[model samples]
Target: MDARFLGIPELAEAPSVAVVIDVMRAYTVAAWAFAQGAEKIVLAESLDDALALKARHPDWVALKDGPPAPGFDAVNSPGLLRSVDLGGRTVVQKTTAGTVGALAVKEASLVLCAGFVVAEATARILRSRGCDSVTFVVTGEDGRADEDLACAQYIARRTTETTTDATGFLRRAGASRAATELTEGVRRGAHPDDVALCLELDRFRFAMVATLEDELMVLRPHDVPSPTGTAAA
Candidate 1:
């Protein structure tokens, strides 16, 4: 199957199997948390919703939310996740784009979380599962384009779909001046440590699944890691 890029509205109409990318922090951090041993991650679209989930499952999971700069939980920093002992624990998080993007594509048959941090891993899983078609969902920020598209482009390159013309999107968004910024630069504005984490190609071996249980969207990481521990091809 070919790969295509779709916005939130288009995403709502696409087929079931799809890959969601929110690289700036949401999916990137989620991948980090899972790598650190987090059993699952509850994704909330709003800060209040995430906090409320914690209120209901205080003993069931941990909460992290707020602006991209990090809040009570220290922003969406993948670096920070690695330091914590998530072992068997779950994290309930809300992000500006990632969480909302994942929730937007809820109808997808296979809604896997993705970003530059885990692009290679995500693709390998999809290929192993015999997936040929993909629609990369990029969560727009406040109606404006965000770094999510960049992440999507990064992963889309590994799929059967033609390579994404990242420059085209950047030019269209008028963020061309920020071209030199790259992934690390974009991430630094939010969480420098996390930017570094997102750049680690194929650091993990497992893929993350966005699942829903009791009306809450959660991420469940696989037990086995990828053979190469690398990102998308």
Candidate 2:
């Protein structure tokens, strides 16, 4: 199997399997939301569409770009989602990177959203499926964020059975410009815990696979089997 680590700009040429990574917050938040019992997440390209969807389905939570709207349940923060009740609830997510990357690579044979949390499971899925080529789409700020790049590298290392300094990778990501921005936001009463959460590696065992359901991108947890033939849910 071959794996290519590219930025979001390379999504035009779809690969056999594309793994969209956004470690700063987007994919991390989605993984936490799913783990917390979110029924489904609908990826919206624009905040207007997200709002419109929220208007149509008032029960669903609308996650916008900036701060959480007054009537909305939560923002795009994994730390915030940790405290909210997402049981059986649907979320409409609109972000600058992760969601956009997932939607853009719809042409891929398989699209999966990943973060540090599910890196190993994602690698397992790729190996299990026997994919010839895998593309890791690092969806960062214009595709240059170090945190996302580090995550892509980590996943690639896991898939290819290579060794990387995991501790060094996390340390570098914590000091990245994106992480610094989020840390600054934390001082202003934003979710301070998200910075630490996003940097934690392999926190979850299930891969979040993106699939189209009724024209909406829905992310669901895919349990990967361990080497011993047991399912890792």
Candidate 3:
């Protein structure tokens, strides 16, 4: 299978299988929420949207938001997600990157969620389903490039099947700038612990993919048919 990079527009136009990557934290938090036994996930494109979902499903989910600014619940930090009780509940998540990316790929045939936390599982799910083509849609705070590309590289590494040459996109996108900024921020006493956590790969076994139910979009684990010729549905 060949890997492709698609901006939101292209993603909206073609509509094929896609893996949304938001590793800096939205999907990472989703992974955490699932680990905490969240029954379902709703990835909203905006904070207002997420809040509205929370308003409707108050008992089932917690509202989590993360904007690009500091000191806002709209920020994407895994540690913040752990501090809450999401046990057997759902999360109406609105992150700057993840949700937007998810929304962008709404036109895709299969919009399976992907991130560093479940990179390997995601790859297995994709391969098991025999995804011959993939579009790595990177959503950002304001549609920025860095974090998503980092995640794309992670997914690309696993998608390659043999070697982990994930550096192509990173190098092409000049990931060093963000690397520097991240390191400097850590040196300046900003979220050093989180910086470490974000870089770790495959620390989970879950896979969250979007599915349609009564004309609504939602996330669920990749429990579909396996590529080993076994029925999973």
TM-score of each: 0.75, 0.93, 0.77
Candidate 2, residues 165-227, lDDT tens digits: the string is 577678778999888988887423258888999887878888888888888887777888987
Two-way lDDT contest, 1 vs 2, winner: 2
Instruction: Give the top-scoring candidate (lDDT).
Output: 2
Which regions of candidate 1 deviate over 4 angstroms?
60-74, 140-147, 161-190, 223-233
Candidate 2: worst 10 consecutive residues by lDDT?
Answer: 183-192
Candidate 1 structure quality by residue, lDDT tens digits, 15-88: 67778776555777888787777778888777777666667776544445334432234456666566777788
Model 2 per-residue lDDT at 187:
26
Where does candidate 3 stray beyond 4 Å?
Answer: 12-14, 67-75, 141-144, 163-192, 223-233
Give per-residue lDDT, candidate 1, residue 54.
Answer: 67
TM-score order of candidates, best first? 2, 3, 1
Question: Could you tell me which residue pairs clash in candidate 3?
Answer: 65-73, 65-74, 66-74, 66-75, 67-74, 128-227
Candidate 3 local lDDT, 65-174, one digit each (tens): 42343212334566655666666776666655577778776767888777667776787777667788887786653435676666776676676554565455444333
The number of clashing residue pairs in each candidate reads 11, 0, 6
